[model samples]
Target: MELSFKGMTALVTGAAGGIGRATVGVLAGQGSRVWALDRVGLEQEGVEVLTGDLRGGVLLEEAIARAGRVDVAVLNAGICRPAELEQTTAANWDETIAVNLSAVFHHLQRLAGVMKKQRGGSIVITASTNSFDGEAGLIAYNASKAGLLGIVHTAANELGPYGVRVNAVCPGLIETPLTREAFDRPEVIQPYFAALPLGRGGQPEEVARAIAFLASDWASYVTGATLFVDGGQMAAKFGTWTEEKAEFAGGRWRLKPEP
Candidate 1:
């Protein structure tokens, strides 16, 4: 289906990052008047860049005000500080919760008001597959992501009455700069991807497409829902690919060629 954002206005946070950059391109290419927000300055050809930290509510308000009217808002800014429960510091926890969860709440609150007045809009949050699974060494990241579901549910319910829809996209092992190290280590991904039915990691563009769908008219009836952009990683329990039946090559697992 064609996802068109012709003449619409969109606001995207974390626009300097992988998924954020891809989302900006998708929305803008589809005809949306896109406003890209990030802590660092962005130099995209057609996007109106808003440089500021998401933790501060001021930048969010500024973007909303400048946009004049927001038809779609992508709450995508986040940081991942990996540490096991025993090793996770209070400082790390606070920072993660602040950026990943608290900031999202504030953004949603402001966007809800705008959309409510307009009587319509879509909000797509960048949640993660870690939101559901207890991945090791990511106590704070996992907690923050899980907390987003609560926000999605609550926001969708309250905003529905005002003709606003809220949803989330849960990506798994997307190849962004944040994850470049992991993607570089074949030893790390071989075992991890073996369990994934798709036998590979995802790309930022893939996740962006999912975000676009949720933010577009194509998902007119979808709200308070989460679309997993994982490569079937969440579906397998005992693992899908095996050394005997598949080979780990070119950074991913692939089935053996048929004779």
Candidate 2:
């Protein structure tokens, strides 16, 4: 399926981050006029950058008004605070929920209204595999991500009548700045990626491509769906790689060479 966005306008939040940056590049390369929003300022050719916090909802409104019409909206802004339930601070929990879940809700509400009037649009959310699993050391992050499904399902249901589609991409162990520390440590990824069928972590561009597809016309019939951009990690409950058949090196796992 050809994912062409020629003459369309796309808005991406968290534009400075890994997945968000990649999504902006994908949309722009596919011929869409892209507007990127984030707390940090961004400088990219042919892209409009909106700098501000997602919590306020003002920047979101500004992007919409300036773009004139949003054919696609990638609600990719989020924060992950890793702390065990006992250690998770109230401030951290509130902040994580505000950015990851609350911001999305406000943005989706505004986007829905705009798209409903236009009678067509697509909204792709940045959910995570943690949405389904209770990963240790991420009490707040997991909860916030899990809450996104409620938003995705409800939005998709209500927006379908207005010709607007809502969906989510759940990425697992992607090599983004948020995960750079984990990827840098061989000890961390060796055991973690061993559970994945691909034996490696995914890149930002890979997730971006998924987001682009869901935003594009190729997914016209797909809505209220949660697309897993994970490397078979969710499917492998017990993991597939083993030391007898595979070797861990270079921050990834690989099948051992035959003698």
Residue 167 deviation, candidate 2, in Å? 0.2
Residue-level lDDT of model 1, residues 1-259, one tens digit each, is 6779999999999999999999999999999999998998889897899887888788888888888999999999999999889999999999999999999999898888899999999999999999999989999999999999999999999999988999999999999989999999988999989989999999999999999999999999999999999999888899999888999999888889986
Candidate 2, position 248, lDDT: 89
Put down candidate 2 lDDT per residue, 186-252, tens digits, no spaces.
8889899989999999999999999999999999999999999999988998888999999888778
Clashing pairs in 2: none
Error of 1 at 49 (Å): 0.4
**Model 1 regions more than 4 Å off:** none
Q: On a 0 to 1 TM-score scale, where does candidate 1 land against the true structure?
A: 0.98
Give lDDT: candidate 2, residue 146: 97
Q: What root-mean-square deviation over C-alphas does model 1 reach?
A: 0.9
Q: What is the lDDT of candidate 1?
A: 0.94
Q: How many clashes show up per model? A: 0, 0
